[model samples]
Target: MCLLDKKAFVDFITTLWNIWNYRNNAIFRGKEEDARVIWERARKLNDDFRIHNFSIWSILPWAPKTCKWDVIKLNVDASMKANRTSLGIIARDLDGFVLSGKAIFINRVVNSESAELDAFLEGIWLAQSLNLDKVIFETNYACIINHFCKHKDDITIFGYHIKKARKMLDSCSKVDIKWVDRGCNKVDYSLCNWSLSNCYNLSVEMDYPSDIHNLVISNVI
Candidate 1:
């Protein structure tokens, strides 16, 4: 068949050996073989080997960093409960100092994707209201980031909000929209969770409420 890199070739050979062993067991030893289980085992084996030997994760661990000297980093998240959705955003400067943060409650029911996009839109507005000239908007939802990356003339249902966000972003001197894993977005998650229960459309001070102290510290540290 096709040639592969050294690591891929080794993995391929190992998977083939495992499959051949499975076939032998099924035919001669009368053992049952599950395709799903075999494939999962092969993947797990490959991943574990790479993790231990290659140490890839050790090089690029998930730690959200501060923005550039002139840019503010905004983390936004949405949490849905029954029919209502809570949107949260936290803005921090290059020194990890809080700039502005908000927790808003939307009174209507919306799908998770829409909720995420709505939260993102709120973040853009929040940045604009604070007169932030440079921004790096970060979200945990990869799909929403992809939505922003699409063409400006997109005709999808969420295109309106995306277009508005892009327009607001254009006003900024520098703007970046990026996706981070959930682990790196805890501050936004905490803000959304708090908003769902306590703060309904409230603007938070730099020294946020006592409840969010740990979360803010964790992110800054």
Candidate 2:
């Protein structure tokens, strides 16, 4: 077995046990109030138990602190149809050592042109809200990126989204939009799948998917 600190192992087991018990009582037994009480009691017990041996191990840090680079990765993908299309956006802070925040936006509308525009506008709004300065916007659609960079003004159907994106771009100090292979954009694809599965609602600052999380961890290390 892999060696682990005895105290740390015990603490992990205890926390897991407490979580299981709370879930069992609340969800399985339908005793939500009692479960809440038990959860509070467990929290207090854990806190009291650690009072004597206070150590950094007891603290659970969700995001690592060593990450110095903050890069925003924005992606857009669309599913085309004869008369309609579906669009998706995945905007995330891809940090080297920290757990990044994610935002997913999706919509279904008539035509791929409109869908691309919507995705672009949504990405801009997300970047602005997160105060992202160094953005690396990516998409599987090379044509869209090329058009945006070349300042193509003839895309009337997506003109508004393009205009808004341009305005947002002007506000940012540094921005780079690029095209990546579809196989390399799994996180963006997952966000699209998730959006389609959830009926096109908005998910902001959601948990990263397992595959994406694993990829990020492996890369960071």
Candidate 3:
């Protein structure tokens, strides 16, 4: 377990325990469990234990400040309905001013975690489109972040998407990806709602739509 910190080691062992327990139940109690279910259960157990034992989340990094003039804090969000998923991204400056935004609707089916990862890739692409070098991408979802940051390599189907995001980030000069509390992501969530409701994709660099743009500074996180 080279450099597999406390949290990763805990989750890894929890997963093994879950797999063993699932195997026993399947044999004795005739409870058939899928691989996905076992993994999720292990993750839940790990999270619960972490909360009770170490309160690890209290030390999690929040949305970083865009202290420099060129640095931008980009909040990315995703919402899925049926098979269609909407991706929303909004960038703000140090003074909480809107810089760039995107709302993309993709007609495909993917798990919620995978779709959130898709929004993350979209955020990177959005940054590239704006030719940004210093940017901080914030998301409420933690799966992809933990996958890379915590060195969690799992058998989930979304692993490919995570790899894609990794290669995309390598070209950047300064990049930060972190998990922000859901309450702090209301603006992007609203942008996600708008995109899904209209089934439209939008990219704006300046003078963003009056409705969603107004939600940023008012609900600064």
Candidate 4:
């Protein structure tokens, strides 16, 4: 859904929740001042609601307030130089469950920054091959996400990958690239670490992790 639609829907639901909660509170017994205060609070929440339309609360209202995006497509990999260069990419589709793919490129002269760019490029390529036109492309590396959407280009090492990825993206219909908190992208990070340890190219599919799958189901409902 678009940002405006998401925001409007969330505001309506939050207002409903507020009304329901206040109806159950004995303290809300038609006191003019108390009622005014409650109304004001609701109004304030509506304003605050505009700030995070993409948050999980906007979709799964009945789930815990903390529950957020239930499904994610993630790519993880790393690069290093210990007398030799190594790079890898782990692409995962997570929805209440996890499905994954991994790739390793040895002697690639990639650093952490380049690895992140490479992972995103590889993820986009995979998504395109799968015909996932509207999939969300997320990364913990803010710089990479920024670059993906033509925001800024401060990272010099991954210039080639960036250019190649952009050319590839031009052929896709719609791809939403976004920056996510590192904590939320832990699965991808783990895959990256695994690739580094194994020092081999890896690609496979995995079942959706429970938390992510549940989140997806909740959103659909």
TM-score of each: 0.64, 0.53, 0.62, 0.49
**Model 3 spans with C-alpha error above 4 angstroms:** 1-69, 151-157
Model 1 agreement with the true structure over 1-221: per-residue lDDT tens digits: 36788778868877897798899999999997788888788888877776676545453354544433478888888888867788888888877777778888777678888888888888888877777788898898887877788847578877767877788778778888888888777878877777677647767767677667677778778
Q: Model 4 segments beyond 4 Å from truth?
A: 1-72, 77-94, 103-109, 151-161, 206-221
**Superior candidate under TM-score, 1 versus 3:** 1
Provide the clash count, candidate 2.
0
lDDT of 4 by residue, 1-221 (tens): 26557657766677677767777675667533366667678778977655455744454343322223333454444546563333333344453244445556465555677667667767776665554544567666777766666635535545656767777767545556677776565555554455556666555555544644453345334
- Lowest summed lDDT window (length 10), candidate 3: 59-68
lDDT of candidate 2 over 87-137, digit per residue (tens): 556665664332233334334355566666666676777677666667777
Identify the candidate with maximal TM-score.
1
Q: Runs in model 2 with CA error above 4 Å?
A: 1-69, 80-86, 93-108, 152-161, 200-206, 209-221
Candidate 1, poorest ten consecutive residues by summed lDDT: 59-68
Off by over 4 Å in 1: 1-69
TM-score, cand. 3:
0.62
Instruction: Sort all candidates by lDDT, best to worst.
Output: 1, 3, 2, 4
Model 3 per-residue lDDT tens digits across residues 1-221: 97899879888889999999998999999999789999989988876686566545644445533433577888998998867888888888867778888888787766888778778888888777666778888898887677757444655657766766777878668888888998878878887877787888877666877776578757864
Error of 3 at 83 (Å): 4.0
Better of 3 and 4 by TM-score: 3
- Candidate 3, number of clashes: 0
* Count of clashes, each model: 0, 0, 0, 15
